[model samples]
Target: MPRTRPLPSNDYARRVAGQFISISETRLNTSPPRRLHLNVNILHSGFVPSAWRLPDADPRAFIDVAHYVRVAQIAEAAKFDAVFLADNASIADQIDFRPITALEPTVLLAAIAAATTHIGVIGTASTSYNEPYNIARRFATLDHVSGGRAGWNAVTTADLGSARNFGRDTVPVHAERYARAAEFTSLVKALWDSWEDDALVGDKAAGRFIDTSKVHPVAHRGEWFSVAGALNLPRSTQGHPVLIQAGGSADGRELAARHAEAVFSAAQSFDESAAYARDLKSRAAAYGRGPEAIRVLPGLTTIIGATEAEALRRRDELVDLIPWSYSLNRLAGTLGVAADTLKLDERLPDDLPLPGGGNGNHTFFHATLAQARTHGYTARQLIRALAGGGGHRVVVGTPEQIADDIEQWFKGGAADGFNLMPDALPDGLQDFVDGVVPILRQRGIFRSEYEGRTLRDHFGLQRPVSPHASADSGLTVNA
Candidate 1:
């Protein structure tokens, strides 16, 4: 076969062998080893509702940019993955006693992004109240400004108080909200994917700034939104801002399966958290997505001290600071029972029913009940267990003990990671970073230094391809 095409030579065999090894390496690189992820929740004061009353706590810190910037600096120094800011349209907490979710999330996060270099900035936005186009542009702008360290926590406004703020007398029905959310989220993603990856053509000599042909209108007319134009801004550095979701209702689960890249969940027990992970991943597979596509991060509040005894003492102090009337009222609100009916020393009512007619926080109501039932905890005990956060699980112990619990949850498949909410800010978080993070690092489950420059990189997520581009590249536009 000394013709035009000769027989394979030794050189050809060597090249083939190199290519096979290259392919294997590529696969290995794409699937990074599983590790623990952490994001700190920067609620006013801290996770403990009365943390502002602590000696070093600032009364006006909720509105102070300096306080947030200081926390961001600490988190960045520790190589934390992100800092999350949760929002609600109306006052969700007791304003007179402690700060509420006061600042607009995206706006506040914009300031945080300026002060920090690498930590991811995430904020909540309600799909039920926002226009898809506006949200798409806002998050895209944030991604671009932050150099791709931006995430959006998608939620439907959960209460009638929020509805009243928007001029509606009643909250939208549960099904209606989810239906709108699914469509709204889909439309926002479509708008993000409207422009092709090659759409930006900056040719200074020729004076052609963009390739108009590569840009297309989304033209979405869905049940919830009617968006006609392409996004004014170009695609951000990360392609699209990372999508984060939080909800526990059945409809909420389905929506997360279809769209979320990360989920913030609230489960009271290890078994419950693991079950939720399984169910969500299975649903995602049914939607033609891989099980590894989404990361499940359940909320974990910690009260850490030098010793377990001191940790319990600190928790007792915080619990004492909270007026019993407020705890009783808050628990009553979650259980949808009368405040007078709930005695602080007694266990939750055995015959408790789900909130009447879906007019409350469905996820946390169920979670709170489940925890109470599982532990047979009294109202006072449950109040202390939650550390003033309505349904988030609380862990009170020394730094070593806290690290052990986190490891158990991560290795046991109870969580992909945790959204850590320390009992107090700056100081509380500082203790975890200085104490607990070292243990995680020594165990080889958390990163000692950031591996990538973007939020998706930090999460080991792939940059999405333009849906309008060729199918051979792996992305397809369904809308």
Candidate 2:
């Protein structure tokens, strides 16, 4: 007969109760604190159009892998949450004056991932141009290779240049692009969930390698995509690479609420940013997600100097380097108006309708318009305030001042953090890391050391569990 297990004694129960009370006391003493997340945008030379023309800047840095690697190394040393790479399929910018987004994002980010261990690698891929399967696979592979430090920024390309590159003479309408994007994003998430966490058995003794019943075929048939089955590879770490979105339209916000784990926002004022955040979180709640499910990181451009006057001088110097014609043309492009229409000393046109008749970039248009209207700035003053950039908020100050602005935004519920675009790369980023990061650390809002390895962990997001594992149902494997 099997021996009977002994029941717990009264003394044992009292000991257990004592241990529980101790743990309860500890929990009472400690509460979960809000942390600030920071990511750096490696925009070729930097945010400034004339950044490459700096005496120490490299003209070829836009295409140089070494230059990107150096920047990633600096960000890693500073313990940044991620390094982001933006993409454009065509020559959208005036390449004659400045560098364009030349390198493909995922590819470049993979190289950056190889060079750094802790920093997350996020890359933009337009749903308008690419198939969902390819994107799902590419990011999954990146996650596997980088030890789960990959993120996909789903975006819709609106420019005619990108449309023509994809064999379309006319750009798709705004609604259609977003509709397709919604389907594309859903299908990608399904594909990522096709394989169960325990699907790979690898049992050498029994010669049973995989639990075929555990792998699922998504069979997703949507208006935009029709995927037959499961992905070719196993489910990646962190389940799926973090989904990030950057759009400010109503449709964009809805898409973000449903799919995006993080959003890169563009707002010109604190009130605007706070309102945006509140609206976005409410939308997420409507989708049955918690308030903490999404992170709002507004785009911020910083021009750092030892003093306020010096920072202004630096801003002027960089702005001066950009030709007036280039600035006018760029602003015109963003506003969807002819360069001749914008007078340097005059305010923007009163009836500046949506760019491309309401199909252009809504985020920048609204942000730039808000800045102009709020401050009553002329075209020249607007350009100066933007620090030669188009839409993002620009902060020019010393390290302490920069820290103060960041702390205010973070605590005021305006932003979870910022997607920082320094005035220049390498040196500019180095200044922030060396000067500003210490101040942030001292405030206890930022991390001194990385708490985890994966990008999701860095962002304080939970690792998504596969549906197959949760449902415990039969799965059909595709050949």
Candidate 3:
């Protein structure tokens, strides 16, 4: 006899959550909350390079509300754990080559929230350009609007172009940006916790709605922000939106160690990923947090096909869709080298060096080079295999092969979960949901069903306990 737990149905939303996640025995034989978490980072207008041209793809997806709605619906139908959106404060060099879905992320996610039900909504916002109170309030509103399914991807805008947008001539130095980020995050969280979880008494008969005595101010006098008192909104359902960070530098890792509940990272190999995970966990221990407190999710972009040959050909086709000049400029911009210096077949020029005076983005440059050398690729072949500027690792294969790769990575301790981005929207994602997902279930790796409601629950993260507590609680622990 299988024991059944109540699904997080909309009807039972208050007692459960506004999600219909059912907890039951998995075919993989897993119990509650052990099921794997999956989040699709919906790269604006879809992840595919030619998504806008697909038969079902909306030609105006880059700016159409319905286009965004359609994609979110697909993810919801597939029972994905969440949908993520990324943002930049300003224009980048590649807008001419590609369409930018630069709609305000919070507004966009709010639209997404209204368009779909039961899928987590994550939006990227930079602490470098945003004030803490505004960010805190915006995310809080989204959480309430979405019935508790909101997440925030905290970022320190790295591109120099973003500084001018924020009324600065240059981006702040990496460490200074991170320093502000840490303080910014801490103050924002304090605001979220300013009012006790049960502060909203809702005592309609008594004509009292809030317990003012239970609320306090966050008088934070930090170097960058001096916020006082409470956040305008009450404590969100998740306590605070789940904190996700996506920088892979040393300072980035340290910041994640201190605060992030999940990490979005890029690593070329299993060994590198495993080591990086180990280092992050060690750092978390320094902050008095356990390994379980944070999750590491690597970017995994997959191109699927019924046959391995077909998959490879599909990947080749998309690479061909991108203009050579465009790919070259992108690679050049990232490599900190001129487009003229790079050759189609020659080894990387001896003069090519790292950026930011040694605090460069090592992950991409090294990952690209490793692919070229190990795979014996020419410049064209390398760029094509790299997949659309090749920021994340690219995998193309039959469904079974893709599942095998993911299973190995998961079991190998290289990642707790994967942040999937398809080469194109809808179709790219459709193949994954229809193909790889089933095989992963057969292999006893990915989940066939949801085991919990909230995104935090999906990730097996506990609700954040209040920092404000009875004096007796802290004293008793100290004693």
Better-scoring candidate (TM-score), 2 or 3: 2
lDDT of 2 by residue, 1-479 (tens): 11112213423323433443344345335645888999999999999999999999989999999999999989988899999999999999988899999999888888888888888999999999999999999999888878789999999999999999999999999999999999999999888888766666665556766678768999888888889969887765566799999999999999999989999999988899999999999999898887878999999999999999999999999999999999989898888899999999999999799999999999999999899999999999999999878899999999999999999999999999999999999889998999899999999999988977879878877666666653322222211
lDDT by residue (tens digit), candidate 3, 1-479? 11123223212322332111122112113534344567898776555455555566665667776766677888777777788888877777576557775778779888988887678888898898989999888987888777667888988876777888778886677678889998888877777778655455565556666667657888889799988878776665555688888887788899889888899888767887899899999999998987677888888889988898999888887777777888887777677678888776666665456656544455566666666766677677778777765567888899989888888888888888888888788678888988888777777666655555556656766666455644432211100
Q: After superposition, how far is residue 138 of candidate 1 from its true place, in Å?
A: 0.7
Candidate 1 backbone collisions, by pair: none
Residue runs of model 1 more than 4 Å from their true location after superposition: 1-30, 471-479
Deviation from native of the Cα of residue 120 in model 3, angstroms: 0.8
Per lDDT, the best of the predicted structures is 2
Whole-model Cα lDDT of every candidate shown, in order:
0.84, 0.87, 0.73
Work out the TM-score per prediction.
0.92, 0.92, 0.89
Higher-TM-score candidate among 1 and 3?
1
Query: What RMSD does each model have against the real structure?
Result: 7.9, 7.9, 5.6
Model 1 earns a TM-score of 0.92
